[model samples]
Target chain A: MAAAAERRPVWMRAMIYGFVATWFILAAFPFIWTVWGSFKVELDFFSIADWTYALTGERTKAEYGSAFTDAGYRGAWIQEEFYRNFFNTAIVCFFVVCTSLTIGTLGGYALSRSSYNYTFWLLITALIFRAMPPVTLVAGYLLPFFQWNLWGHLATTIIVLVAINQPFTLWMLHSFFKKIPQELDESAKVDGCTQFQAFRHVIIPVMWPGVITTGLFSFLLAYNDFVVTSMLLEEKNRTMVPQIAAFLGTTYTEGNVMFAVAAVVSATVPLFILVMFFQRQIVSGLTAGAVKG
Target chain B: MKHRTFFWFFLPTAIAMLLFIAAPIVSVLIQSVFAPHEAVLIEVENCTPLVGCTTETMIDQEATRDLREAQPLGRFVGLDIYLDRAHLAIEEVGQIWSTSETWGSFWSRIFNLPFYRAMSFTLTYTFVVTPALIVLGLMIALAVNSLHRHLKGLMIFFSLLPMIVTPIIGSLILFWMVDSRGVLGSALVSLAGDPNFSLKASTGLTWVMLIIYGIWSSAPFAFVVFYAGLQTLPRDTLEAAQIDGATRWQQVRYVIIPHLTPLVTFVALIQLMDNFRVLEPIIGFNASAHATSLSWIILNDLGGETRQLSSASANSVLTLIGVAILLSPVLVRTWQDFKRKT
Candidate 1:
């Protein structure tokens, strides 16, 4: 009787399994299908006569004399110079993460340690800034950028992204810093250290875990950004995301949809690897604010 | 920390935020109320040999260039841009209000205007997606929690894909599959028993598709949060319910849900703000004909050969107001919390 009560009924077990299976497919199937389809000719990938052609790649076999081909990858990476955009993305993400974290740590540390009321107001101000849509801010930037001859440059976009990233970065690091005991730094101050020295010697070394987590988010923001990059960067300096968007405009007309597909797959690879390694950090970062609040 | 010390530490970030975030907002405000100077017009009398002199109004190119170069911020027009047809469309709304007999007709007529159309979709998407994602996330969290330990990690890894991938890429992947020639699109066509069926062709179905995409991409965030919340559940309370002969449903209803209520609100608040800025998915899906968002409208206005800076700025100001309204409750609650702490 105890065993019977402990175990779920057969129907209940089956229901749970069925639901999980559906969600698993819902989450995973699209990417798997697209990656598989990306190797084939457009005809086979988007086959109207038979869907199985996508899986079997019948036209691809006939055209390329093999089941798989890298024609799309060749066109995107070579002919279209996607590597330039990839390089631009790398540069932007690197600088944005470094600059945002440096300033964010200082500000966030101050916000956490200060016992003043203005710190509270500053945080509230950051929260309001965080909620404003990036596009709305872009409207304000155009006139000034054009006037100052700063439009369509990587440096301008990177600085703007860092500033936009500041609010969230500051908030996340502020919360993380709050968890660190104030006594660690206070004792350093007692031991004949200035405030900056205490922060540099005592707090900085222990802040890596929180900083790394915050850095991952900053990297993602810069990497996955579309609006800012698309609006601010020139055609030659476009990042992976805006480049992919640009691909769609031309690819659709030229019957080169597979190039866009391949480019998207290429763009997703680094993120895929990032999640694989930093899954724990990502999960924890997401819950940090929610759990505490 | 001393005030001077704190000031030095906070200066870099404060400068960044002030110049980029705060200044742009001020710029948007100023831009919204101003219009670019009209090309300086001059009237000239032209006479051809066989025709009488005719006074012709022509754009004075030299003067226009000088004017624009001198005052690059444009001429101040007060609130005219905000009231234009592309934005708030006050005159259009008034006409629709007076002419339409029923509430439904009035609403339909008003929605035909671009700004109202974008607002309706943005609001509907926000309100619908936030709650729906929370519910779906809870269900997934509960179900995944019941699975074997080994399978749990694998499920989470796969689940994070939709959320972690670039928004445009994820939407494009889904959009391709739902194209009329693609697999799901074909299956949908067959299911509906119509050869011409396409998800992108209808406004209602396009919205439903986008809403589904919204839930799919965001449900993982909620799930991860709720699942973490579930791990911290008090085991003794569950055992107490079990000893009381509480069925599984009753345990979930009475014990589990009450514990997870705070988490639900957290997820709802975060998702609301994120969904209100839905633009990339619309672009990825290429469904702007059927659906438009406030962010998308702003982007469209700012793009093209002639950048309509004034119009876009007005839309930006309006969007900011909407965000402020949506955010007031959070702010008020935060203030109360601060008061309590003090």
Candidate 2:
């Protein structure tokens, strides 16, 4: 975005291109190869006979009698019941996003609109909580969750995740609320609407960008989390990331390593789709945190 | 907003934070000082012919059960647990220092304790990975910034995938590729001209792989921040530098870097906090045998069958302390900024 009008020498320009092109390969190669190799059989994917067998799918054809097979996916999804984990993840993420945004929007709107000293302390508290590792807090959660018999359920996990996510959510949404001109809501009040009605009528429609941005992160936290979900949830109530980890534990020794590989690739698909669709918002969200601070 | 409105609006999140976040800190703090109750013992005289007059002690199940039911949060042990080997490891560390002949041997012995071992790795990972990723991120940002516009979006789309993908899943992808017979691992073996080379077998190589994974997953974050910061760079300054005969390198060193320093600080702060608790990669790579972080140690304690809550809580307390120490500078800066604003 800076001025590029000043002409650079050909060698310098080529060096830049070379560096970036090399990185592009390094960054993209693992994912591309993994996705391709997931279709192949185990021996071909992790071929000791010849490394080229991985690329050529030769061993896959010999072993599975086809170039591609769904054995790994089937093993992970059907035999392993990974679909339940997937559904658990969806339920957790859906509620986490909804709960976090509902509270976050109200709190964020108030923080931005108010002129109290407490607001500063509230934000600071969030910052501190955000810095604490989620695992450390999991220790605190276990005794209580176990005592209450809430340890293994998705609802318990959802509540904990939403709490863990609130700091970031509130911080992001607070900054977001700060950017929206206060005059919009002020005029709504002047038009004889109560504060709640003004917020509902004026702020709700305009708050989606910030809400969606925050919601994506909440979803990511709830979905991607292994420590809290793994520790808190029961074996019967596993989520995708933890289930993928569980795959490595069981599937590896069973010589079903390809099943774990397939699970990893399956888990990545949603994130890939997310990044593809929401790259710009995610980029802006990252910078927004920086710039605002 | 009025006080009434502020209170009502803030209540839900505040309550959530209090119950889940704030209350847990207090729970961890209290639990850290308490060790679980030991079972009651009863001395009984054996009057059987084979046993003669020998006495044996047995666990008093009724008394122990009642005792446990009474104080299930565990007996308050003060700082006894924290000073034990699982935490500060005061006596062991002292013995190691006193017995070891040299600093090299001293460190080796000290790290044998799980607490010190985890702390050593966590600090090393944080110190090493934070700066390396910052530099890598900046380079990537500069390179991508100079690319043709059409390629920029596509490059960014690919780059964001690694960052957005779950940490365990992302590392699993890399871990599989670096499996002994997998692509990158095979490449390394062939490059080294050693068929036996494998990431799984070596601690040093595993740490390298973990650091590389850290950079791979996190650079996109720094890149995005720096890229956005680049867009906000003053064009006039660059033009003035050009007029002043600054070379391309000079233009970057003086103009570009100086401008992006704040964003660098921002990225560095966040990365420090992140790299400190590097847990998932250890799990995903199955590399805990090679390296364990503070978060991993805490997980180990909590995940075990005994559920060492006291030990885990102590580690959690220490971890939170470490987080606070790392966070202080940023907090102070934030405080200063807040004061100025108010």
Candidate 3:
């Protein structure tokens, strides 16, 4: 703990500081630039006259009589009806998270407690499923979903996401459940509680930390999903990501690129807020598998 | 847990996976072997004023619809789609193999084929990005670990921004900046001393931009994992190395790296699988013209006015096989571990 033990040479310290500073700029500058540019008109943001026009918002000021204007946001949210997509995304993420977590907890709890060989196989199967890029499954879903009249619905997309999310959820929650000493549940069972009762009484109360962490990831998977949501959901039911993608298709032709820019910034804010609030959990959740393995 | 109790607990998730994950693989496999039913063509003679009894084929719409409605899985081509020019292109590949005079020519011809083009980009991106991210992540983790305690949190918060944002959105944010009219593109234009210099117009630069974006977006995951590993480093060994007059480089090279070897494997396995799919960035950066991944190919097939289900399904199967190949080592390791446990 002494200062001498932690000491580094001046040059090495400077190099470390310099490298971190460079990485910080690389990591943060793009989003900062985009967010700042979103409020400007397309010309000022994507200024060919001078790059500094983006910062000054010269054209935006000339047009709107202010340095900053809500034109992009207004166009995206009001004119293009981005709020519909926002609400659709909210509905999908809400149900997907809830359903996936409920089933994932039950399954993960079972996997952690079971000593059977099948449990090993089950976990391995989940691993294999986890490795499959979700887009690969979109082709498969299209035929069946269309036939069964399940395509073009939020419910279908949500269920699909929940299923797609199960493997990772089960893995994270299984590891977490394993960490909760078996004796806690075993002792509850000995007190005349059935397995279900024991789980309800002992495990559920203590499982929130892991559940919340898993829930954050589930929300991310559903929220950040493009392939499944885009392919499955109808245009009217598209989520935020796909809606932004659609914006690109039309916006470029119409010279409304700022709508897509504004939409991209808007889509990113929730994630920024998420990381701010759950940095510890997100970090731990990322490392949990790595460290344990 | 008893079998009965476990069954009850696991049933819902099992059904979900079976219906969504497991069933889709089967469906994709089946669909890959089948092309959409060909239009039922019929020969008809039309005696017009200008032309008399010129035979021509026309699509019999009613019969075609009936045929499709009857089967619904499309005509069973049985690997024909997999070998056709759009997919595996078995015949085209053979033609190139036989006619080409040199390996370079052979590869160039092969690269012109859509499937090979996508596969090359996917594989190159996977292998290149995975290792690059690991190195970059390790560097950042080590540098941040040395920072004063208060500064560490702020650094980490900023560092997570690239990774935490949605992949498409993150790429779009970067994409806009790299547009010809935007900041970075103009900078490159000036630096290159050419007005026409554009990242999007070149295959090599597009790949470079995407690979850079891949590393930027994913390095934080590696850093977070590595930083966490660093926290658990045994202090005594480090102090002992110091007492033995080990240099800072030696301490890191020997003591730190060896300890992080397992986590390196962990990150490598995860990153390999993740990078192999590299789809969203291609879409966001509009790099599809210059580069495409397996996932991108499938997306292209599935999107637009024409939904080439069979072609997409074939690509999906091929992509899964690639994943299976990439994943074999880990699967083998897990199997060995299970065997030892039992």
Candidate 4:
């Protein structure tokens, strides 16, 4: 009995350490896999542990240089294609996030300050729109686009993306704006500041963190969205996801590995940036959104 | 000055929403019913009609004739579609309900066997997945709530990872993991020494896969909310209960659970609404074959080769109705809770 009691504390401590280590491993696997796979050459991707173990076993620097320089090779062509996909993703995400914030923030503010009878209804409608299944209306939009000669247009794609994301951005901003306290607005008015001026100078600064958090969320959503982009874009203008899907769906020997690498590269960048830049805001904002009251 | 100021400040937002969001939704509702009425199929006889009019009308048979073509699709024929389908019954005498159509093929889907089945499956899916998420999420929140401060941040971040990743990317990862020769499959073999356990074996496995996958994606979200609520919960209430000689179970039953009723209801409402409308995982799992949920069924019906626009509208209307019916009570309760809090 005495011997068992002496060992219990040490055993419990070891168990806790094991549990913590396992939790960390499980959580970080996707991020680590993505980064490692992104840097790995195609052939080594799916060999699993072998790929990591044999990192220095059979490589030549001359071949690596030639692989980049070879003008006629299909592999080199695909490498260039990825560069284009990455650029497209960046441009689309940039515009979508900026536009949604500008429009959604204005809309959220109006809904917040207004005494309109349907403001709550409008907010609810917006939430429903955001939550509406994307697949339901995507095909409907495609039919119109095809008939109207608007197929393959970036504007159409952006509109659909904006529509999908606007509700949430508006919702988040609404919650944030609501939290600024009415007393702040009242005090500003007493100080001879016009409502607009008070909003610009006072409320906007107080809510800047919330805006950034909402912006990050919107940016990540637009960057990572595959369905609307895939449905809207043709092969020539395909985005990052469809591009990766093409490689992943390929039948070549090196296809799986290359795909894993590409997938890792494309999805991980924004996620890492988010984690690094707005860790606290993202966490707390999500928490607030979750617990409604 | 205050009244005038409020009006001026609110005008831009109100106008923008009225134009963009309010306008589009109204248009969608209109398109669902009346907008489609503009298309009508017109059939015309050509110059020197061959069968019936050739003998009587064609002395100058060289006369050219014109015929107006009907609209190719999407014509609204009214409530004829809804009523005719509601009147259909089982084919007991091998009549197969043929040639008795009051409206058309599109109208018949209201009583269509597949439609009801899909609705049932959707309800079942929503029912199963929502509770699973709430339970798993609450457990995670409770577990994490018990953690020390330094470890709490790390765990919270980990919990939030799934929500941060794109659904498409996460689905793809899940796809790869569940592949027969992939990481998940291999892990099962290593742990249980069974190589034949594959998710692709049946429709049930597909359902299982989707449910678990959803739980994975959503549990983190629930956890974060509940955790935040847990953190802000009044400590004195629980302390008082403990001081009164309440057991752990009694303290939790009387103090913690009741205190968390608002959060619980809020999470439940959100999860229910969200899960009811989930489309991605089902689509990824192949919504057409095997098991079909309401969203997937509606999507398929929308995209079917017949180009049945009215049927699609009807299906969506049914979905919207179903959602309203299912969510109304919870929504009312939440509204009441919000009222109390405010």
lDDT of 2 by residue, A1-293 (tens): 42472366778788888988888887898899999899888888887888898878897788778788888889888888888988998899899999999998999899999988988888889988989999998888988887888889899888999899999999899999999999999999999999999999999999899888888888888888999899988889888888887878788789998788888888888888888788878888888789963
Q: If you assessed candidate 2 against the hidden native complex, which CAPRI class would it receive? A: medium
Stretches > 4 Å off in candidate 2:
A1-6, B49-51, B340-342
As for lDDT, the candidate ahead, 1 or 4, is 1
Let me know the DockQ for model 1: 0.68
lDDT at residue A291 of model 4 (Cα atoms): 48
DockQ of 4: 0.27
Write down the RMSD of all candidates, one decimal each: 1.7, 1.5, 1.3, 7.3
Per-prediction TM-score: 0.98, 0.98, 0.98, 0.76
* Residue ranges of candidate 3 with Cα displaced over 4 Å: A1-6, B47-54
Off by over 4 Å in 4: A1-26, A30-77, A115-118, A143-151, A242-257, A290-292, B1-73, B79-121, B189-197, B283-288, B297-312, B334-342
- Structural RMSD, model 2: 1.5
Q: Write the per-residue lDDT of candidate 1 for residues B1-342, one digit (tens) a residue.
A: 999999999999999999999999999999999899999999999999888899999999999999999998789999999998999999988888889999999999889999999999999999999989888899899888888878889999999999999999999999999999999999999999999999999999999999999999999999999998988999899989989999999999999999999888888878888899999999999999999999999999999889999999999999999999999999999999999999
- lDDT of each residue in A89-115, candidate 3, tens digit only: 999999999999999999999999999
Evaluate all candidate structures by whole-model CA lDDT and list the values in order. Answer: 0.94, 0.89, 0.93, 0.62
lDDT of 2 by residue, B125-217 (tens): 899989998998899999898887888898888778778889998898898889988888888898989999898898899889998999899
Lowest-sum lDDT 10-residue window in model 2 chain B = B46-55
Give the best candidate by lDDT.
1
Candidate 1 chain A weakest ten by summed lDDT: A1-10
Order the candidate numbers by TM-score, best to worst: 3, 1, 2, 4
Better of 1 and 3 by DockQ: 3
- Better candidate number, 2 or 3, judged by lDDT: 3
* Model 2 / residue A282 / CA error / Å: 1.0
